[model samples]
Target: MQVLIANHGAYLSGIATTLWLCLYSGVLTLVVGTVIAGFRVSPLTPLRAFGTAWVTVFRNCPLVVVLFFMAFALPVLGLNASYFVFGTVGLALYTSAFVCEAIRSGINSVPAGQAEAARSIGLGFTQTLGLVILPQAVRSIIPPLGSVLIAMIKNSAIAGAFGVGGDLYMTGTRLSSAQGEAVVPVLIGVALGYLVITIPAGLLLGYVERKVAIAR
Candidate 1:
């Protein structure tokens, strides 16, 4: 408690930055994942192929490897983004691949007849997806997507290794090294900080699932 309070500003700054990155990455992941899920469920062969390849490549590869490639390889290719930007982008892309699969499974669980009925009512493909399919898919996917969000938050700790500042892990590293302690307190502090975000998120998702089940 003493250590935490003494470094309150540092800890708070780190948590704030981590939360910002997590929120940004999670939102981007949801959007990208949704698009890929749509493609995977589409009838177009090329779209399916593209989505399949994306999920395969990202899901199969280690996220740290992806981050390394983004940080190192992208600069060599003349596209240099900041450490925070690159780390968040890589995390989003990698996580989105898994999110895409989860959402695709949810979409597949929806009945094809609903889409057909929407089309019979003169709705275009996009309109049918927007009005009839995606809402149900989203409702089914909320719990799983919440799990993905928690995973993404935990994974953001790796940003410290990539030279991104203001993450909880990075701040902990700085404090631990500066104080020359055994790192137990630092680890505990970081864990608690993570729980501060993840526990509430889990509870909220649980509540949503219960509400959805009751409605059904």
Candidate 2:
């Protein structure tokens, strides 16, 4: 208890920084994912292929490798950025691939007839996608998007390994090494911190899903 209290500031600061990174990355991922998903479902073969390849490459590559590349290779190529920025950007891109797939699945769940109806009303492809198909798809996507958000939150811990300071996992490691104690409490705190944020978001998404179902 004394150790925990003594390190409270470090712990809280770490948690706050990590949570901010996660939230920023998650929002960026969602936007990128939505656009990539749109490209994937586009009629143009080239666009579809490009989007597909992007998803495949990002999804299949190890995230640590991606982080390493962002930190080292990108700098070598003159794309220098801070470790925190690089880590967050890399995580966002990697997580966006998964998010794209989830959203694409939701888009697929929408009936073909909806698009057809929109077309019959003389709606252009962009308008139809925006007003009709996407709205319906969003109803089915809430739960999966929530899951992706949770995954992003957990994965933000990897930022610590890349030397991004003030992340929860990094603080835990620092505490363990400095105190020379087993890391159980530090690990426990990290887990509970994650759960506190993620579990409520998950429940909220569930409630939103239920409401959407009732409305439909």
Candidate 3:
């Protein structure tokens, strides 16, 4: 353990970077997914089709494939971003598909009568979704949304394989080699690090869900 902290604690720094990657990529995923979800639910046929295509393409693809494309192929194509940047972008794009679906499902969970009520009151589709449907949907989807975020944090490990610096897995591997404590403890530590992020996030989301839950 001390070995991990030695030399300015490179492993700890890598864990921090991993956390940052998850945070940034998670935010990007949320934004992109929300837009795509809007597209999926839009009254416009073209928008729905585009959203369907987006989900089909990204969701079916492997995370590693997306990561490799961003990390290696893009660089070959004259795009020069850091491994961390490209990794985060790839993660966001891939995870955004799942996020979109989860949110859309939440939207569907909303009572259809509510939308009708909004429309009868002279509210537009956007207004109905923004003001009436989505807010309620959010409550129903909190558990799934929490799952998606936890998945995102775990998936961020893929970035480490591609040389994204300060990543948990990469850092763990380095610490194992440098510290000579065998592999199990190092990996356990890595898993614990992930739990540290995920457990609290899940608890917090649960708290929010309860706080916002509609009266029975």
Which one wins on TM-score? 1
Worst 10 residues of 2 by lDDT: 181-190
Candidate 3 wrong stretches, greater than 4 Å: 1-8, 178-181, 214-216
Query: Against the true structure, what is every candidate's RMSD?
Result: 1.4, 1.5, 2.2
What is candidate 3's local distance difference test score? Answer: 0.86
Q: For residues 1-216, write the lDDT of model 2, one tens digit per residue.
A: 666677778888887888788878888898999999999999889989999999999999999999999999998999988888998899999999999999999999999999999999999878988899989998888878888888888888886689888788888888889767557877776676677777887888888889998998
For model 1, which pairs clash?
A: none
Q: Model 2, stretches more than 4 Å misplaced?
A: 179-181
Q: Score candidate 2 by TM-score against the native.
A: 0.94
TM-score of each: 0.94, 0.94, 0.90
Give the Å shift of residue 3 in candidate 2.
Answer: 2.9
For model 2, the local distance difference test gives: 0.87
Rank ordering of all candidates by TM-score, starting from the highest: 1, 2, 3
Instruction: Give residue 208's lDDT in candidate 3 (0 to 100).
Output: 82
lDDT of 3 by residue, 1-216 (tens): 543335336556766888899999999999999999999999999999999999999999999999989988998999998898998999999999999999999999998999999999999999999899998898777778889988999898887788887788887877778656668767777877778778888899888878777442
Cα lDDT listed for each candidate: 0.87, 0.87, 0.86
